[model samples]
Target: MDMQTINTFLSTTAIELLIKVGAAIIFWIVGRWLIGKVVTLMQAAMNRNQVDPTLTKYLGSIVAIALNITLVLGILGYFGIQTTSFAAMLAGAGVAIGAAWSGMLGNFAAGAFMLVLRPFKVGDFVSVGGITGTVTELGLFATTLLTPDNVYTLVGNGKVFGDTIQNYSHMPVRRVERTAQLAGSVDPLDAIVRLKAAIAQIPNVATSPAPEVNLLDFKLEGPVISVRPYTHTDHYWQVYFDTNEAIARVGKEAGWPAPASTQIHRVTQA
Candidate 1:
């Protein structure tokens, strides 16, 4: 071909390529902005309807991901790329990834089921996946927990769902179990009365069901008294410590002897 013709063809191709690149950039920026706005609006709407915050945030994330994927496909189509073939390829890749990362997929599925079943929500004090803590977040693949010792933990949703879930905050009150050993010489009935009175004075103890001070069993040292106090989960630790103090105080006031194991030695005579 002539140099002049070649130069003209090159110039045209360069201009077209630049235009396509510019359009693609604009499309990407516009698409991303639109996706953000859509997600925000949907979240706002859910909030206005008083939807659960956890579910709203989860749905927002899912919608944003789906919208972003659609936007990318649209941009590809605009560039004259066959999006149908691309989508088919994406599906094939997803299957391969799902097979390789089956645990992740299981966690995702478990999260969806948890959302629907409503077993527990964010901020609930629960024991799941062998970890006892307050739920910080119920995410797409994992559940975040802030433990009693202030440790942050992440448990896979699959494990959480499969394990036994203990929701400590579900009930209005929880029973604190404690035991007190009295000396063999101490009157069991009198000790029970003193303990019940002391436990009743402890702060945050539930009044309806009342505290229970019952003789649990007899050991070599003394009779065992079960000291059970009902209190709200939030005040459990406080009440637990206070209950122990009360037991000590009652024993001191009654001047009860310290519990000791009794043993007897028999002397043989010839």
Candidate 2:
């Protein structure tokens, strides 16, 4: 009520606000420095361990965000703001958001599972959810794939995890299986033996497993000779192409008849 009392009250309030402000500024600076050091150390550890780049970056970002958030809340609390109440409100809001974005949360969960399980890693060619490509990046919500055509594709982790994942590059060796079609007149038993021998000549085909050739089925045109060749995954395409070419060459030399053409004759009603 008095002028002196009013002046004293105003001075005290201003001094307290200034002190809180100064302390907040100091805390922020110190906290950020410490956070930076911690993050740098973490990155160095990851690099030393030969961790995947994608995972390392993701982990660092998450850690940085969490630390920064803690710093902000600490600063806010220093200013006499009720951070506990704020956190409670945020938790409630997070629950609502989690429910609202259930699908996105599912993707996050799936990504976490994928990281833990290590089903496939970057640079591995995988088939999931009908999309086959090399995994370029694995994010928190989706997996980025570079298709054979060089097109970038994004598949949600939730869907990919739910579906089957076939990692063709998981192992060092890959088996190339092909069915060579032959004309009905061709004798498969003899040709199968010869073809297997010819396919074995390919240098890329591995010797440990040994090449195999057997008659798979009898179609309208001829017998289908199943060919299984083992080779290194990196040289898969070359082996596949060379094996296919060899099959044709061997089959032709063995007097295997060519496929008969299918002629569709549609006569209009007169």
The true-versus-predicted C-alpha distance at residue 213 of model 1, in Å, is 0.9
List the lowest-lDDT window of 10 residues for candidate 2: 255-264
**CA deviation > 4 Å runs, candidate 1:** 1-45, 67-84
Q: Model 2: residues >4 Å from true position, as ranges?
A: 1-11, 43-50, 182-185, 218-223, 258-270
| Candidate 1: clashing pairs of residues | none
Candidate 2 local lDDT, 93-150, one digit each (tens): 9899999999999998898788867899888989987899989988879999998889
Give candidate 1's whole-model lDDT: 0.92
Clashing pairs in 2: none
Question: Can you give the lDDT of residue 266 in candidate 1?
Answer: 100
